[model samples]
Target chain A: MKFKIAILGTGNVAWHLAPALEEAGHTITEVYGRSEKNIKGITQKLYTAESKTDLDFTESIAEIFIIAVSDDAISEISDEIILPEDSILLHTSGSVSIEALGYSSATYTGIFYPLQSFSKDREISFGEVPFLLESEDQTTLQKLKKLAKSLSHLQYVVKSKDRKALHVAAVFASNFSNHMIRLSEEIMARQGLDFEMLKPLIIETLSKSLELGAKKAQTGPAKREDLNTLEAHHQFLNYNEQIAEIYRLISQDIIDSI
Target chain B: MKFKIAILGTGNVAWHLAPALEEAGHTITEVYGRSEKNIKGITQKLYTAESKTDLDFTESIAEIFIIAVSDDAISEISDEIILPEDSILLHTSGSVSIEALGYSSATYTGIFYPLQSFSKDREISFGEVPFLLESEDQTTLQKLKKLAKSLSHLQYVVKSKDRKALHVAAVFASNFSNHMIRLSEEIMARQGLDFEMLKPLIIETLSKSLELGAKKAQTGPAKREDLNTLEAHHQFLNYNEQIAEIYRLISQDIIDSI
Candidate 1:
């Protein structure tokens, strides 16, 4: 069930996936990137993976070729890369469709999207990450299931359409939530209060919401519909129209949703 | 430095604070609430606390009397409560000013706002919770400091003006951030995806934001200003105008903020 994988692009996803596959008992046959420095950054983590600085994957004997690039570059990279015959082609993007790899000459085309954010410097527990797999053929689909199982117990067979929703949901959950903290930091900065004061509250919010479910755990003036508190906050934020506007829109959304 | 304390409310704040104070070696002399059941709920956690269904505290011998009621009721209860002379009167509210207790007859007046959201059924680590303190006199401030030190190391002497900003910032950090998750849950539910799938991403979002600071940790279509992905998400959420509007405003704000 092990894969001899060739990862395209030396970005965050590629950096993490290369070593994770190696630790999961798969051999990383090759690591490809435009920059030798980036390619060297990842190949250093593997046992015997050769580094390639070009798009000519023709020499690669990797059974699975993973294009771990940006959503916009998936098609361009897939179109240009030449792979070995009968090799499986995969792109690890939540937003891009499986058909994005149609230009590739691989015998089997599929998607192996890991539904989590990745940073090159941060370490992730691969076992807890959920893998979303999709393939053009049943054989390749089964192959992906076995390959995904080797890395994590959390795996799902999601079509491209539904995966888009998950991708958008992730944007709201991670990026938007982080921005909320950023806004809090900005507000505290104006008052000369240390951002450390908000850390315990931030940690507790996630814990409480996850435990009791977000709806049940929701609180504050907006949730309580306290006009006085909301009005007071509006007056405080009025100096910065952008932040005040966000506060107004989100508070209204919370109220309307309830 | 252990003081005999009397708590005025049996809500979430009172429920948690009563037990936390007792654990810190303070004696809860009396707990007053309109409902006998609510009083018993918190009073049961203390060693020698007496429960009072009525507000009259003429016979109470506690050194510190805490008004842990709602913002609207803080002044009303403070006006009606009969406290012993030289007793420190405090209201545990973030938004309410220390001057709200001006009607009280107690020798010392202050605020003892714990910067956290509490649930009656949930267990909180008091050591991690920050206590925001304010007092009318220097002697009372020192006394409150000693009391806060016994329960938590995180204590700040914030004035009413700056504390309002902290309270509002907390609303953005905890309540608003939670609603973003709720929006994600709703988005997932529409796509027939389990909420459990988003848990790891949600957890990582908080961990990364806290570690790197929120500004450095932000990422997504909006942060990148990727029009293609943003357009795709806009189309997906167009059916619900409220959600679509929230997505639009937050996205635009993220783009503008950068």
Candidate 2:
């Protein structure tokens, strides 16, 4: 059965999700945000100009309402989500739990967290993103699993706690890793080094790390404990204390990890 | 003119470089190592049994002898290099300077530091690895540049001091970014999560980081300063102090970076 779904929010997640669900043959009846103008771009992609600026969502009929707003906004939005009886309400947030949607006593509530960053301008196939589905109710969980199954092959039935753990891991994998490259750019920016030059090495090392298993793939002066090279690198970073400290700590961690 | 190359060491760099150079039509006349038996495996791929267990490289007749050895071994092996008069000698080291090859009086020395981590078992196209070439003497630098240009399009003429800086930046880009993934793996491994689930996120974030510029591409609670999610993650990691500490430090750094 093709489920009728309504989408809430006009951010990155909603932008990607709206088109993805519509393309998958699900009917997205309406898109809601604080301002209809804000979600016009996303709703237009669904070939439907049905957008509403409503604090309390009324006069909407859909089997599921996906709230893809920010974590802080989720609670207030859920208060506004007065969906029909026996229908489902879900939030696409890795950090926020299913309990955040507790305002709807008449509907089944759940989580449908896609574990990847979404950008409004950048297109990503929904099928490629890992969808983490979770709920305390079996019926709601099964409903989510079925809906998620239609979108991506990479689906996981995770508990709220484990999902939280995965989210933390993700922050490390994505956020910290990106910061490391930022620092790399900062260091090279000093000597007028082109960022393009470092791209291949960054890509190669990531692939190698995955293939060899992270532990086995570890290399460099820190992994080798070449104090000579390590010292040389340290002295070079003497002008920047924060970066030097990070280098020292991470290198020490790698050594200690061994 | 095709350079006749003698590669010293049978490690990752030597193993990849020998075949890459040979395929590019340079004559790989001999493969030298501490033990001939060790290099036999590497040399067989070159369709030659020209393996030499030479403590003192006295009889090597090559236009270029590329010492792709360990940092400490570079000095000792440089002492052993008794190549033809005015022939090119180079050590493939990021940290070790051209001065390390000062032990050789009969040859003009330089540096041919390939800037990616190589695995002996994993075949890498030499053209893909950035070759950082450096030489004090003009003639030797030109000769080294010519040989390097034949193998890779990504070539840089760097000074010894600046090259060391590049090496340090590489540690952050490749090594630390890799360790971030490793930590991600460790976190997920606890809950028996499939590493494949995280691969898409890792790849997407890394690409996005490069595309948007790292500072601009950064996302997560740290970037948002979402203390609720950050505190929840911290509590989840309380049992593992080291990981928790790393998490705290890196998150703090990301927030500070903004």
Candidate 3:
């Protein structure tokens, strides 16, 4: 049951996923990256098999080729990487179309997108994250689904279009939410208040979304249309015009949407 | 010790705090609100306590008065209400100055601001929230601190100005974060994705923040300045001009700040 895997990128996803896949009892046949230093460091600690910065990627060594490159590099990486005609090729992009692999020689190509944000230093438990798998053929889809299931507790065989949709959703959920937290920190710093103080409230707000749906769990001046409190906060943001403008626009949007 | 408490105003704060105080072994002698229905509801809940909607709100009340009215109403309510000269009057407001309560007949005045957002239907555990205590006098401050300690595990002796700062911080952490989730839902809806799919990412993003600070935990196109991915997402948002604008502005802000 130990299938061979090759990770073709040394970015955050590859850094996190390679170790996790190895620990889950799979064989990483080869690892490749552009930076020699990065390739050397990852290979030294992680690559018991093979590591290379050159474009001599061969499909004969591994049954699955995971192109974990950036969105821009994924198509080119897939196009250039030498893979076996029968071997399955997958990209870990949320937004990129699975059909981007259509030009490749591999008979089976699809997406193996992990529906979570990855940080290089932080250890993300792959089992906890949902993996979205898709393939043009049923056999390949089933193979990827089983592999995903082995690696993660949550796996869904979503359509390619659905996968694209999920990717856009992840941007909003992970990317935008983090931006809001940063904004909060900036506002607190400007006011000479420790951002740590807002931790409990942040946790509670997220938990409420899980307990009650986001629509029902919504609170604050925007939701309540508390014009007085809104005015007060706007005045308080006098020093930061950009943030104040953001506050007004977002609040108005929320109010108008509701 | 069973401190006598009178809750002025039957708003969301009073609805939550009064019950929490009673649960913590304090005796609520009276509940006051401008609406008869609100007064009646609280009176029915606490049978022994007097509930009155009229202007005569000072008779037969406890030694401690908690003003849980709106920020604009705090000064007006304090001015209208007469209390025992020795009674300690406190307003449960984060932004309003402590001087708002000085207009009351009570010689002792302070603030008992609980640093949490409350809704009428939701039952919040007071023990988990940090109560920010402030007073003009040392004796009243000490008394309010003691009261806060009895009801909550975490208590901070925050000054009025600091409390206002904290309020703005809470807006970012709580209000803005909720809006972010809402935006994510809207984005997913437009993309034909179920909003529930983003729940895991939402929970993980928040839980990660608890361990790694938001700045260090940041990720996505904005963080990396991945123009290809950014352009793709922007193209994806062609139909939704409002959200696309928001996405562009926030992403630009994050990139600029970083």
DockQ score of the complex predicted as candidate 1: 0.85
- Which residue pairs overlap in candidate 1's backbone? none
Model 1: how far is A53 from its true place, Å? 2.6
Tens-digit per-residue lDDT, B134-168, candidate 1: 98699999999999999999999999999999988
Judging by TM-score against the true structure, name the best candidate: 1
Q: A1-258 in candidate 2: lDDT tens per residue? A: 467888988999998988888888788988888776787878778876388787445566677889988999988888866666687888999888777888764368889998888877687977888898988789889888888888888898887778878888898889999999999998899977777778888988899888888899899988999887888888889998877888888888899898
Q: List ranges where model 2 is wrong by over 4 Å.
A: none
| Best candidate (score: lDDT) | 1
| Cα lDDT tens digits for candidate 3, B1-258 | 678998889888898888788888889888888878887766676747787665454566588988998877889988888776588888998878898877678788898988887777777988788888888789888888789989988888888887877777777677777777877777667666667667777777777766776777777788889887787778777787877877787788778887
Chain A: TM-score in each candidate? 0.97, 0.96, 0.92
Taking chain B only, the TM-score of every model is 0.97, 0.94, 0.94
Task: Point out the worst 10-residue segment of candidate 3 chain A by lDDT.
Answer: A40-49
Better of 1 and 2 by lDDT: 1
User: How do the residues A21-64 of candidate 3 rate in per-residue lDDT, one tens digit apiece?
Assistant: 88778888888888777766556656475877775565357888
Overall lDDT per candidate, in order of appearance: 0.90, 0.84, 0.79
TM-score of chain B of 1: 0.97
Error of 2 at A255 (Å): 1.1
Q: Give the alpha carbon lDDT tens digit for every residue of A176-226 in model 1.
A: 888889889989998899889889988887899998888998989988898
Order by TM-score, highest first: 1, 2, 3
